[model samples]
Target: MVDVGDDAPTFSAPMTTPSGDIEEFSLADATDDGPVVLAFFPGAFTSVCASEMTTFRDRLDDLTDAGASLYGVSVDSPFALEEFATQNNLNFPLVSDIAKEVIDAYDVSMDFDALGVEGVAKRAVFVVDADGTVTYEWVSDDPGIEPDYEDVEAAVGDA
Candidate 1:
């Protein structure tokens, strides 16, 4: 998995924008503007995923104040992501890693064999600075777990 101080692996993928439009998103381009918070979730509309995403939505201003942009990454299709964003009233974009390339690049891919779900991203968060270096990383094998919001905000400030 990617760790702090490591160069972040940049990727481009389809995403559902805040304006409910489907578009391509490039991690490198996002970092070029400022720090970026990539929140990788197992799936959309799940209980823990919903809570985690809504928490991020509520705290978006804090990250933005620190000059950071946030994006929630998932293996869901962009169409599903658009509906998910609308349902959650999320103000940030939701990246669709349907091809699982981003998850693989970050080494955070996982599977739920019993549930027949595979190639989904494990719950993870990475704070990438403008220079493309990961300033902070948080990953969890437990899908129910969520990252520390305060710590992520602090990392953005430091970045």
Candidate 2:
């Protein structure tokens, strides 16, 4: 798992933005001016994922005010993410890690054989500073659990 103070691994992937555009998104682009919150979830359209994403969408102003941008990461396809974004009325981009390369790089990939899924991303959150260093990291094995928004907000504020 990625840790605080560690240099964030650089990555770029195709993502579905809230505007329904599919484009290449990169950590470098997000953190170019300030901090970015990368919220990783197992998949899109799940109940927990919907709740978590809605929470982020609702609190976007606070996050943006703290000089941070937000992105949701999942193993779902860009098309699925687009639908998910539309359904939830999310204004942030949702990255597609369908190949699971980014998931492996971040060490957040999980196996769910019981659910008949493999190489899904674990529920995690990373706050990356403008310098490309991780300022905060949170990982949870339980997919149903959500990150502490207050802590994430604080981390972004500090960054």
Q: Give me the candidate number with maximum lDDT.
A: 1
- Against the true structure, candidate 1 reaches a TM-score of 0.98
lDDT of 1 by residue, 53-73 (tens): 999999999999999999999
lDDT of each: 0.96, 0.93
Cα lDDT of candidate 1 equals 0.96
Taking the tens digit of each residue's C-alpha lDDT, what string does model 2 give over 81-150? Answer: 9999999999999999888988999999999989788899899999999999999999999998999999
Q: Which candidate number has the best TM-score?
A: 1
Q: Which stretches of candidate 1 lie over 4 Å from their true place?
A: none
**Cα lDDT for residue 134, candidate 1:** 98
**Total clashing pairs for each candidate:** 0, 0
